[model samples]
Target: MQDADKNGNTNQTDGPEHSALLGRMLKGEKLALAKLVTSVENDAPFVPEIMEEIYPKTGRCYSFGVTGPPGAGKSTLVDKLIARLRAQDKMVGVIAVDPSSPFSGGAVLGDRIRMQRHALDEGVFIRSLGTRGTGGGLSRATGEVLRLFDAFGMDVVIIETVGVGQTELDIVDIADTTLVVLVPESGDTVQTMKAGLMEIADVFIVNKADREGADKMVSDLKGMVELNDCRETDWKVPVLLSQANQDQGVDEIYKELNNHREFLDTHTTEGERKAKIRRRHFLEILGHRFVKKVEMLAREDERFRDYLEEVQQDDANPYEITKTFFQDEEFARKIFGATQTKPS
Candidate 1:
């Protein structure tokens, strides 16, 4: 969720015990399943330790993030997508995030119930993460968990975000290909084009296409695409219509996805660009971690507060406060010790 400490690999308590357990889980040890879930679900005392042991081994999966408006039927879309993927003998991982309502977790778990036909199927692993107010589209450990599945050798990882509003469109940070799903009736065509979604989607899907207005929505999407100003290349972001519940157009989607993958594979500059983006994102996460830590320490430290009070009263400025905090050898050492010294 939005809790600062809950998101990163900074929570390392058990120096070795949790590491061995994480190693086992990565090695296919069955018992580690419950332990890992428990560690994450209860915000376990040693999760920071667990993430540290597992972080480096991540970034190994094709992480796909699925997001859209609340009633876009993202869950059902994922279910149908999984079914099609399973036919290819591909291993799939699903991460569903929901709001902070008391039944949020229960509702997400119920998605598994909707797709129970795949319960006995080994090719699928379904996980439901309560959003816990980690807005901008995902849970705190969303990327980490996708990496876990990747390290586990999952062929595909699907992330489902609860809300698809502007503020919730955080999937772009994690997913290589983020498909913004919209139903015909939701007026997603106009909502999407007007809200800058045209750039976010590598592909636009109009789900529930069997409805009466479906064709108009699809045409509307195509019109928007044609009117798109970015004509630098022949690559047009395709708009596809699908009736997922009826098992329609899944193959076309697979074909488009594969084509996109192929495009990335051949584009030489992509590697460097992606590396820069990833580094920037990790740095932002680190920045968030640092800001939270400083805030927490300042609140708990009398010296920092007296200085803050003086600054608030305009008797002293931030530069002086910053100088005092940095010049205080004891405080400086503690802060540095508590923070990660390495960039990675």
Candidate 2:
């Protein structure tokens, strides 16, 4: 497979198939969308080109992130939220991040099973993504997948993380609003929250409110929110309770989600906050592409392979070798120049 470069040269990384798939996806073909998502998840060679073509269609969908500790009823809460969104005649896309299967490196929890009711709904799209050993409770492909959903004409996209405690703050970077779901047993988590979950929550939910100590958890979170003066914005973080199993108090949570979204629309539209988000996203893309380029080089370039061999055999100091490689003008040319000439 190959595509033409800007300078009339052929690059062996992309072909017509992906472009045809993208065309089908944009025309509302669900199968095409699914195939494109699989390609993104697997880090296909054509991802950069695909994203470049679809970038103009993104930013139309508002994204929400739902994350918390395992067994906190996060899945049920998301299910309920999806229904509410559907009731308003909105097209929804869900990216449920599940723990990876050790053998296949695929999503094992199968969130689609729990969301079976919406399986046949044309307005709803649900996908389960494996964390693939990436930290921050999300697959490395999550950001790109969300963009694909946006370009597919979804009104809203929800990202549900793998429920890893504390370290799941990456959602704040990608989601327009972040919902931190907790149970009454999570009192200890709140008490020791430090700078992690507590800082990232745009809305706090104490799910399974029928359980004991639920009220106290709500009060404690509210008190924490009051004492936390570090927020730069005027939007007050709301703490709500829900028994998602019985469908109680979900409306309040939904209402607050909209309220927060509205706040962001009005306040962060064109400020340093928005600029910071764009900058972070750019840096993340740059870092990911640079890593992929290096990986390809290590596989094909004999000199780079020798460097890896020395590190593997402990015959060279990795830090010194890295500094020397950066100093070599030819090394820089190989990395950046290959972007246009080499297959990914």
Candidate 3:
């Protein structure tokens, strides 16, 4: 879709400029990669074009999502994971999704002080993204950014979420393997299950395993996993212990992650999983774009603006209004006519 500037003129970011940037990125230019990531995060008009150009270069990277409660040592775990991947001579890329400041729209904990040690490593590429008030503990552009990292030749791309919540489990929609981190005293095992963590976690890490109640927590998670049995695959979610700060038990956690990856590679269910994710991704983008197009039309059409005003004032119920609006042929003709030629 084409975007109009505040002056109501078409503003696009396509053409030779973005093509040159993509070409440089394909040649392993870090600066080009960084620039493309920034453009994606900002939702630049040229993103669709960039995604089209790089589509063939993706699928080589293994994406992992490290998510859990706040103060669960997720950053430390990610740092250690990056080290492990790098030790094996694999290039790693990290997308640290941090909470955004309501006032500034910037990440409150960008750079995550614990992970700064890898800042200078040539094989390690790290980018901190502000959630920007989006739900699901990640930015809307995170999936696109991962595509850029994959195209840039990262063997493994890790996304550290902004603390998992009931509705913040979108990481599972993107990651090939999801590691849900928790602490010893975080809460009861039932609470974890109620929080929707049980369904999304492929591997569980009880960080700060040296703390009190560590063993009990591990036992509880294993019990819960067993109770919800009747699985299609032989892989059982392993609740491993880890003192990430001390680097103890991390190796085993990495081993479990590898096992999970191997399971996905070998199982027939792999196709089903990918199909599910593809459906979710498609629906999400379609919904976002459809809403955006309607909003743009509402801004330009007098009758649509009046409809929006009525909805805002509660004079008409949104559900009925949406149904009626879509059924109106004139409404469809006008809106479709305006957006017929998509931005290149």
Candidate 4:
């Protein structure tokens, strides 16, 4: 019998099946790409093999991460951006991560509803994901899905994060250009600063610019940017106003996106920024895998269960128990494979 996770994905798939799926995905098959993303999101058994097969084919697509507070019209702005990209004959992929429904554990805001005009466009591929009770505005599998889209030959991929809190700031670590959208009524300059928006925003946009405070909000963002030397490059963060509902000021956003991409392409610090992002991604993957391994060990290892029981009974200090556990080479070998050596 095969074991299943909370997502109900069983751990018995063969490598050849994933290899075939990857082959189809690389050939620009939309259905295959969707299936690959679903497998990654479900944490299927063959995901590591699938990723390895597609890893070499990635890094061609340029990504934009759009984020802001809820009800700030981010979806509408992204819809406009997609139209602009489509005008240039670009093949675009969109990953819209929405907040999960507390009751159903599914995506609450379906971005397709806002972007229905592109439903029949063969050049565009759109996918929506639920937060799945994870933090950082994105699901844990978002990076994998982004990689799949890149490998599937998307010219541009836009990742729209759940616009809920400052925790959604993980988008900055992944996007080539981070576009932080805000509205006049979303919050004030101080609140933006408090939300850590100044540090992550490569371009600040005041959507729904027809509102009364839109110009003032743009002015405030500019002043804040000038006051805070947050950017690592010489590229100045541009703050623009946009009424997305009317499709006004969106062309400027497209122009600025290209300008920012050009700046990064030629900037001396581009390599350093990429290196930092790689380091962050490495640590995140390591931490997640480590925790999952520990959980699996705790569930199956009788010794680990006994240790947990001792800790729960207050018969032994957890710190000492953990210290002893690490010093046991046999236990380490059993849990992390025979290749793992115990620390001195």
lDDT of each: 0.65, 0.77, 0.75, 0.74
Residues 1-344, model 2: lDDT tens digits: 22123222223555777888999999999999999887776666677788889987887899998888777887788888899999999999988765533211224435333676886899999887764433222445788889999999999999887564533566545888999999999877777674576568899999989999999999988988888877777889999999988999999999999999889888876466557866877888787767766766676667777778877774678898898888877668777764453422
lDDT of 4 by residue, 1-344 (tens): 23354212224555577788788888878888888887666566577667767777877789988987777888898889899899899999888765543211124434333777885799998887664433232545778888899988999999887563554676555778888888898665447464378778889999988888888888888898888775566788999999999999999999999998888788846668667866876787667656655665666666777778888874678899889889987676665665332222
TM per candidate comes to 0.79, 0.89, 0.87, 0.87
Q: Give the clashing pairs for model 2.
A: none
2 against 3, candidate with superior lDDT: 2
Candidate 3 — what's its lDDT?
0.75
163, model 3: CA deviation in Å? 1.9
Enumerate residue pairs that collide in model 3: none
Which regions of candidate 1 fall more than 4 Å away from where they truly are? 1-13, 30-34, 37-49, 99-107, 111-113, 133-139, 192-195, 230-234, 268-270, 305-332, 337-344
Tell how far residue 266 is off in model 3, in angstroms: 0.3
* Weakest lDDT window of 10 consecutive positions for candidate 4: 102-111
Better of 2 and 4 by lDDT: 2
- On lDDT, the candidate that comes out on top is 2
The TM-score of predicted model 3 comes to: 0.87
